[model samples]
Target: MPIGKLYGIGVGPGDPELLTVKAARLIDETDIIFAPQSKSGKPSVALNIVQDYVDKRDIPCEIYQPLFPMTEDKEELQRSWDEATDVLYEKLEQGKSAVFVTLGDPTVFSTFSYISSRLQNKGVEVELVPGITSFTACAARAGVQLTEQDDIMVVVPQVSEKLTKILPYVDTVVAMKTSRHLDVLEDCINQDPRQKDIVSVQNCTMDDENIVHGFVDNKKYFSTSIIKFRK
Candidate 1:
């Protein structure tokens, strides 16, 4: 039998409507769906974005939400990856294809990156299906262009002192996962004169979506912020 292939599907940011047509079609055709879950019973944010579509699908598929232990320990993370690989390998070896849903573009700071590399090392074919990114959705909600002519765009997964270090060279800084360092990011933006506009958006396309045209005092874990250095 031919070996089964794997797809790292990006489900887009929190909105079912934002899911790409190809991703939807593949979800219907795939034998199983793997979504990341932080807790045992809780549904994944990525899965939630496409749940409605999954429910309406004519093709039946098994959905597995694997729990990813939250810890900074490298050994723990590796063990988690190994465990995830074992599960995926089981399906692939049986000639069954699986789609792993990710919150944004699978190539961009996704947890699937680690497992995808491992699976590739084990000789499984891997495909990445692109979807609308959170930053793109946030930018649209905030009505700001990521870049203009002669401008540069920089994207960081989280806020840190490194963002301050790069503030002098980049024209725009899009910081995702801002809930961890909102105050620090605000200070960095304040330090740069070129950073003329700052916008923060939470839950970009969902019902509880929030838009802050300027500096924000309230921070949500689901938020992403954009810093525009020029007009």
Candidate 2:
């Protein structure tokens, strides 16, 4: 039997309507779907975004929620990837195509990157379908332009001291995963004299979405901040 292929689909930032046409079609046609969850027994956000499409599939698609723990430990992360790869490999070898759905663009800070690399090393063909990123969606929701002509932009996954160094060179900064380090981000913004505007968007495009004009005091896991600086 011929080995099946794997597709890494980015479902977009918390909006079902944002799913790309290709991604939706692939999810509908794939033999199985793998959605990653940070904790055991918890529903997957990526799955939730595309659940409607999954339900509309003509043939029932098998769904698997793989645990990809949110941790900084490299060893622990690698172990989880190894396990997920094993499961995917077995299905692929049986000629069953699979789709792995991610919260945002699969290439941007997604667990699919690790799994796709491992699958590629094991000789499994993999394809990636890009989706609207959280930062872009947040920028739209906040009504902020990320950059203009001759302007530089930088996207920081986690705000830190490095953001301070980056601020001097870039015209715009998109800070993702800001819930954990809002204090550090606030300090960086405060010290920057050229800071023009800042907006924090929580749960972009979701029903409970919120937009703050300045720095956000509260923590929200899905928060993204768009910061602009004068030239």
Candidate 3:
């Protein structure tokens, strides 16, 4: 049996055309394609983004839908992840090259982290294909500069309290994973009195992309906000 390998491929944001050249090439060459969905029997946004580049002509595809349990059930989440890992392990054991598609860069807040960590522990050969992050996409769409000469930029995810303490010192801040914590984040930013240059970009690089500058009351499900201190 040929040795199987795992490829952690990032599909970038929602745009299919934004896929990295390497990522697109690997999708066409990999023997099998795997994408994880939030729930069972659901379509994967990551797969959908790169469907055009992926040569599904005769490749077998596996949709591993791990339960995205929102509750704080650590045990249940681990169980689901383990079961999902088993499915991947089965494919890997067959000596077939499997591509695990993830949104954004695989190394940054991507689900591939957990799977890759476990696979590495088991001595599975793995390769990573990095893609563009939503933060850069949002910045481009909003026409904002993330950094200037000798300036520091911090990328955070919905940790408003921690950000509240650090925002005063940073020149640029990009906040992600901001659906439920939108209100709190807004409150924290507004309280600083230097948040006049705040801008929010939601569903970046997609058709329904929304960009709001200054103050916004109603927040969407998936969004990112850039807080720039120009004072």
User: What TM-score would each prediction reach against the true structure?
Assistant: 0.94, 0.97, 0.91
Query: What's the lDDT for all of these models?
Result: 0.86, 0.91, 0.78
lDDT for position 25 in model 2 = 94
lDDT at 143, model 1: 86
Residues 50-125, candidate 2, lDDT per residue (tens digit)? 9999999989988999899989999999999999999999999999999999998999998899999999999999
Q: Tell me the tens digit of each residue's lDDT in model 3 across 70-167.
A: 44588877776777677888888898788888888898888688888888787788999888898998888899988989887899876656787877
Give lDDT for model 3.
Answer: 0.78
Report the number of clashing residue pairs per model.
Answer: 0, 0, 0
Best by lDDT: 2
Minimal lDDT window, size 10, model 3: 62-71
Candidate 3 clashes between residue pairs 3 or more apart in a chain or in different chains: none
Better of 1 and 3 by lDDT: 1
Instruction: Give the total clashing residue pairs for model 1.
Output: 0
- Candidate rank order under lDDT: 2, 1, 3
Runs of candidate 1 with Cα error greater than 4 angstroms are none
Query: How far out, in Å, is residue 191 in model 2?
Result: 1.1
Q: What is the lDDT of residue 13 in candidate 1?
A: 87
Cα lDDT for residue 155, candidate 1: 93
